[model samples]
Target: MARAQREIGAALLEVTRHADVPSEALRDDGLIEAIPELAALGETPQDPHWHPEGDVLVHSLWAADLAASHALEHDLDADRRQLLVTASLFHDVGKPQTTRRMNGRISSHGHAERGGEVFRAMGRRLALPRPLVDAVAAIVETHMAHLSVRGDPSPRAVRRLQHRLAAAGTSLDDWGIVVRCDGEARGPAARPDASQPWRRVAARLQ
Candidate 1:
């Protein structure tokens, strides 16, 4: 199982590094099939108002694209860039199991926390490095913090989020990139001002 997980991880890494990874590759290369958790994302519904892209899988792909583009534009180191891309791919891995309808709206309450668990489990199953696994899980766990901060641009909230991520072994620099890419992938329903609060958080961190 360990060996199989390593092979799977390697394949996923290659797919993410491609300049133009087709959505088909996700299925063709067995990424979606071999990983049941990822496969389940296809059936996960999201709030259309927040995710015009339709489903969790589509949104995740868009996020991965944004992550890849940003990594190249910023000239990030290879390993760091790969980390961002991988995290983007699994950022919403738990949405399928967590989705629920509330007040005539779709919501994935605690999806981030659930996603962190899934990410950590995959990392351990794949025998990835401890640091890498922990970093990715930390990013998934706090992926929603940026949106919350956007809704309420309070300095106290920003500081608290920063402290939370720092304690979880994620840097503000990496967190900023992930959050910005996530917002950019929200399709037509995305708000231009969504990144502003994160920008302020970045400044505070510096």
Candidate 2:
């Protein structure tokens, strides 16, 4: 991780610890039961840059909601829906661990990597299914790939992603939906372009 991100992550962790905020408190099951206002925590409200809908915290909630709604429409099996919802909710949990303010442009920079680590720790603590844990990790790792490639991912880029998923024994379809959920929830009119190159890449796998 970058130096600035590392420092910020430490500081955020310090804040969480100092506040005696349990990670479990933010977890789906725990939050649903313990903190009725859990959904309202850590959110950044509307801004001109990046999040037009609000902060990363709000965007994460939107992603989780999108995943839930889409899973219901597809009539996903209970296990699949569980995986999708859990992954969506927890994918960016590491952002709180590593908040960076560069030139007043707040960015988590390397939070994807740190966030994946956070998810892994959370999964182990919760005793999540091994495959589900693995799937979530992959999704977290590649969460920004679509954005990084903009709208024109090369065939080579697609192939590389496919190869990595295959090696991890994960499904592009599962992760693709997670990515779509994220894109659709990021801001006002936040729907992802249906014709995005990466969506085509996912279709080829289907």
Candidate 3:
């Protein structure tokens, strides 16, 4: 069982590394089939007001493309770029399990943390390096933190986030990129100041 899982992970890593990985390839190459976890995103419902893109899977694909495009624009090193893309693809992996209709709306509270766990487990099963796994998990867990910064925007909150990234073996710059990509994928409802809050935090950290 362990060996089979490792093989599956390796295949996923290869797919993620492909520079031309189309959103359609997610289904075409049987990646979603190999990794059943991905299919869950399709069934997961998201609040239409916030996720005009439709479903978690659609948002994730957009996020991955945006992250890859940003990585290329910024000339991020290959490994760092791969990490960003991979994290983007899996960032909402937990929403399917956590989705609930509450107060006449949908909410996936704690989905970020749950997604982090899913990312970590998949990374481990794929036999990815421990540091890489930690970095991706940190990105997944904190993906929502940037949005929250719009409310707080405190220097202390920024510093705490910086510390959290540091402890997770990733840098603020990398996390910022991922967060920005996530914001870009939010379609019409995306906050115009999406990147500003994190930029403020990063500036204070520096």
- Return the top candidate by lDDT: 3
Q: Give the poorly placed runs of model 2, Cα more than 4 Å off.
A: 1-48, 189-191, 202-206
Candidate 1, 128-181: lDDT as tens digits: 767777888888988877666325467777677677777766776677777777
Model 3: lowest-lDDT 10 consecutive positions: 16-25
- Candidate 1 Cα errors over 4 Å, as ranges: 1-3, 17-25, 149-156, 193-195, 201-206
Per-residue alpha-carbon lDDT of candidate 3 for residues 100-165, written as tens digits (9 for 90 to 100)? 999999999999999989878777766877887898899889878866744547887777877898
Query: Model 2: per-residue lDDT, tens digit, 1-206?
Result: 23343343333233222222223324522343232122333553333465676666667767776777777788776667766766666666667656666676777777677777877775565455567677778778777777666666877777777777666556666778877777787666576543257758656655
Question: Against the true structure, whose TM-score is highest?
Answer: 3
Per-model C-alpha lDDT, please?
0.77, 0.61, 0.78
Better by lDDT, candidate 3 or 1: 3
lDDT score for residue 29 of model 2: 27
